[model samples]
Target: MTSGWVFEEAAIVFVSILAGIIFFYISSPSVKHEKKQQLEEGTSLIINFVLFIWAGKIVLNIHIFVTDPLAVLAYPSDAHAFYMAVLLLLVNIVYKATRKQMYVGTVLSALVPIFLGSAFLYEFIEAVWNDNTMSWSHMGLLFILLILFLIRYEQIRPFTMTALIFTIWSLGQTILTFILPYTTLYGYMMSLWFLILVFTISLIALIYNKRKVT
Candidate 1:
């Protein structure tokens, strides 16, 4: 078989695996009451992350089908998909391990920022070192989706912390954009905006949670 056939086969295999994973997770049995709630929330996050990956894949697949098979390789959104998949898997594992812990939310809130911040920083480095361009529209859509998730989850305090950090990062990126005029800087700005948006959503979540508690 030729290289083109090999590439197509690989894509089919990956899509099949992703679909199977989603189906298996969704069909899994519910845990006990409190654990079930955590599972539900984590599942929602996984679903949204998968949806984002699927959307990116759909766009890339369309370009590949119409243009060249190699066109799919031109854009490297696969890294983001892989990253989200790993995160989902980790969340599932952690929730199962720590379900009995009462301060799960507080623990998660503290850890999530560190984990996500690292991912963001890694992506930023990749964008700079690999000479990747910024996808502002995609980032904007992601930001909106994250905000919606925060609203739905009603998690506030952690979200507020995320928002403040993101706002500062975004402002710094905006300033850098004027001074640097580099593609990497532009990408950083896009990422910073998305981060800020995530933070804002977190703030909303914090407010909702506070109201519920009081």
Candidate 2:
């Protein structure tokens, strides 16, 4: 007989795969008529991100996974898993970009949207599944921003779009932090930090592009 845990495990796997595929598709530079190399690079980027997530999970709970392989599938990843995944992904990207003499700005710009879109969908699913009312408003705004992203995906470069989306998301988060009584300030410090990072990167990219044009 099928059990709840089995379904939960299946759902988790499905969501993870779906997130990867979505990232690959939406972030494909050719989707908006960019070069074929961009599509290939985007695919590699998403694949590396997924692989790192799985690897991080295994590395963090090797004992448990070794004892019960099923536990690895059943256990949900936490913030540490996310942090590890990002760290590994950054390392991979940096190594490849440096070795190949690829454009660092282009690579990073492509990554940010994929990250935000994947996070939005995953968080929305979890919030709905767990009946977390506190997250509903934030997720709702995220959905709208995601829709806007889709509508304009082909029109803008990934970095500019990523900056726009992150800025909007950060604004929404700030509003939620203030208006929602249950919102925790400690929980939102990361969002603020991310906002600053996005703004800084976007500003630098703009300045660099302007200098290159002139």
Candidate 3:
């Protein structure tokens, strides 16, 4: 990868983490817990996410690392690594919460808002950095999502809210691809493919959750 590309990736990671931390701090007042508890939990969550990303990077580049231990840092992570890190973090959270018999909805509720903010910020930054005018529209949708989460955070189940957000985002992209047909991001069609997969999976999960509840 070019040095410029590496710098961009590193910038995205740095800003996303900073934005997440700021959002988490802002939402701390919304959390129903003591200051000490919030600090402890926040610290744990940060550590978990950092480790998750590190693990994902190692897993994806193990062969390269085995041959050239110092070369790993030169390789920038892509969307696959981000997705893997997210998957691992989610799995870890589910496992620990279930093992401890913690309230699932409550755990999710506490987690999702911070994520919503971070996701919005990351996308916004990406849009500006990449000079994608179409992406600003997508960023507007993310803004709506963040507002919705903030407004309904206490009233909805975490999993339900999360599913709803995923569905909305996926559906929005599906619509955007048609509405804005001229836009192209290096011909990767990232939004088009992501819309298909996310919409299908989220719809299925939403249906299954509803059926199970009923």
Using TM-score, give the best candidate's number: 3
TM-score of 1: 0.36
Assess the local accuracy of residue 72 in candidate 3 as a C-alpha lDDT between 0 and 100. Answer: 73
**Deviation from native of the Cα of residue 134 in model 1, angstroms:** 14
Structure candidate 3, residue pairs in collision: none
Give the TM-score ranking, best first: 3, 2, 1
* lDDT (tens digit, per residue) of candidate 1 on 1-214: 4556545434543443344334323433334464455445544554555465545555547756466745554444454444444455556546755776334453344333332333343334344554444524233333443344335334345444444444444444454445444312212223434445545655565666567768
RMSD of each: 12.3, 5.5, 4.2
Residue-pair clashes per prediction, in order, are 8, 0, 0
In angstroms, give how far residue 121 of model 1 lies from its true place.
5.4
Expressed as tens digits, the lDDT of each residue in 91-195 for candidate 2 is 887788779856655654555555556556655665676665676776677678767876787776565666566667666765676677643211122344544
Candidate 3 segments exceeding 4 Å error: 1-8, 24-46, 176-197, 208-214
Clashing pairs in 1: 155-205, 156-205, 156-206, 157-206, 159-202, 159-203, 162-199, 163-199
Against the hidden true structure, what lDDT does model 3 obtain?
A: 0.66
Q: Which window of 10 residues has the lowest lDDT sum in candidate 3?
A: 182-191
Native-to-model Cα distance after best TM-score fit, residue 134 in candidate 2, in Å: 3.3
Q: Is candidate 1 or candidate 3 better by TM-score?
A: 3
